[model samples]
Target: MTGADDRGIEHGLPADGPSPSALARERRENAADVLASTLETRDATAFVHAGRGREPSIRYCCESMPHGRTAVAYDGTTDEWLVRSADASDGHPAADLAATLADRGPEGTILTPPHVPHDAALYLENAGFEVASTEAIARARATKTTGECDRIAVAQRAASAGIRRAASVLADAAIVDGRLAVEDGNGDTVPLTPARLRIAIDEAIVGAGAFPAGNTAVNPETVSHPDTDADREALRPDESIVLAATPRGPSGYYGGLVRTLVVDSDGGRERRVHVAVTQSFRSARSLLTAGSASVHTVAADLEAEVRSFGLDDSDEVEATVSGVGLESCEGPIDGSDEIEPGAVVRLDVAARVDETSRLRIADVVVVTDEGERPDRLAAPAHSLSPAALLER
Candidate 1:
């Protein structure tokens, strides 16, 4: 497979695009447009309780918002958007929403997300407004706008950077005691452990101006607990170190990348699985172009191919596929198994190669209107070879 050096790392996003506030308004209006379509009457109001103890649907409606803000948008009217704190002194954000609709704004039925605050639900019901929960916002959020796409791209780049940093670290390390280690300034060696590697990858994500989601994992993974030190084993030569990173961009979006890195090849089961997973990645990505049908079929075929290569763990151990966006998993792709334009899907081919080592190659990609190629946002080295991550 072609490496990052030959293909070149994806550069930074365009600097002089729309400001974050402008981007938020665009998302709000876009969400409102979807909300409008669901309402039976023209005067109905949809109140989305987002962030701060609520469903994080806030991310779909706006790029950034004050903590505890509730969204009240009118049916078919993008002109009026209310994002206010759910003041405790006043009624809850939901109660406030009901009051606002009755006293001043639209005068009809009310719509909210399926997971609404109990207080908010009660208040809306008591206000004599016909209230109901809908998946309209979630469905709307699955389709990314131009601004949303740009924000997610930045995140994807950060995720790629995290993986590259790990692979590069392995490439640069010197083998000591049959395990990879790097010499400290004091000449002591800091052996590569899962926790140590996780820190390295997280630092790279932060350096790229993104926040690590605290799920940076190293398989055959290094884990530490105050109660025990059982999982502090060092990575030995020729063993696979699967790096799975999720980094949150500055704009509250997330990017995902999962790749397996090995210090040296023993030509074992792990290596064979890596090749199969890489090919499966290519085949699955090719089928995800815009307007393509059969996401379920594609997912089934991809999983079947990976399983045929002799790796099997249930869904709890490996997510064969998921949608990547504001909150890691949301989608028409995952929900309905439909290929949606502007949707970012994580085609994760993960399975346990052996008890100690697992093989995974997951990439987050954007489904575009283009028929041939879906955009690989900030993708890193597809090759399992550590040298592939280094720049020429």
Candidate 2:
């Protein structure tokens, strides 16, 4: 239950260490080494398609992994890679990849992701390449190298700092000043009204050099918009706001943080909601050091903790926590899955006390093996004590 201030450090990252770009490069190199050694003994290749359209790059196989690609590639003999384009004039990045491989002229070429799509796997099949499946790809990506662990550590630190900034922002505002407010994407004013502290919390994330990647304000009257825009515009005060901030560090790699904030009127219902949510948050954090729990275990404990408080009439609302990393909602965590080291998971806890208010808490953390347990992260757990909240 100790707050970040009580810990006497800022998000627990090594800010003065090597530059993020350097760290990222080292991580990539380390991952490549692992892949090469493994693949040389086995038989496989990495196929990558990354970034958005127009800027996207695609490659079927590589001797070493692509510089910025988080995925790793295994070793192949011949030293030559190939490039075969369905349409040469199109100038696709995949074509370039084919060219790179052909230039190397490996002993034998494999067709990976042969059905990927235009500029993705289209040219691969035309060039006599074969395909790999979803499960095979997942297993390859799941294993992390030593360098990746180091970079992930740094990323977790960055995300934790961003979350702290968001929490700090909400902590600083007061309802006395005619409702200090911030504008949403639609330009609608979300009042920083007392009990509706999420408005301030959202603004805090923005102040920390990040964007709100997702939003959910579900209430009893939760404006169910058959249309998406209207539902986004009218979030009731009682609603829960699940906000995600993905910040791009100097190295161009992303670190993510997600938190839940809600506003509720002052009353017994509000108190209950706060207690339930606070308890759930505590239960999830307990998993961070216990090491006995998997990512799924963390989610299960949260549900059990909330249920023990008897807040919800039914357990219809399932998981509030998920795997978070380069992407905000990384998966395979909220179910019967395990969380590996260097995985960053964000826990979202929400409880509706009554019709007018709700309580939500989001905490960012990294899954580590540093403690006596399997999961550890640099970020602190979400805890709201009267003294902690009231303090500067």
Every candidate's lDDT: 0.67, 0.44
Which tens-of-lDDT digit does each residue in 1-392 have in candidate 2? Answer: 11221121112333323544454444445445544554454454434332232111222122222332222123245332233332432455555554454455443434242234454455444444443433323323333334434444455555555555444544543343334454545967564432243334334434433333323122213434323443334333334444444543322223454444443333455556557766876667667666635666787788778777765555333446565433345543546556655455667766655454345555555556646433444554443432243243
Q: What is the C-alpha RMSD of each candidate to the true structure, in Å?
A: 6.1, 8.5
Candidate 1 lDDT (Cα, 0 to 1): 0.67
- Angstrom error of the Cα, residue 390, model 2: value is 5.4
Off by over 4 Å in 2: 1-17, 37-42, 45-75, 78-90, 99-115, 134-267, 288-294, 312-317, 331-336, 370-387, 390-392
In angstroms, give how far residue 196 of model 2 lies from its true place: 12
Report the number of the highest-lDDT candidate: 1
**Per-residue alpha-carbon lDDT of model 1 for 44-89, expressed as tens digits?**
5555454452344764554445446464444344446655466642
TM-score list, all predictions: 0.85, 0.61
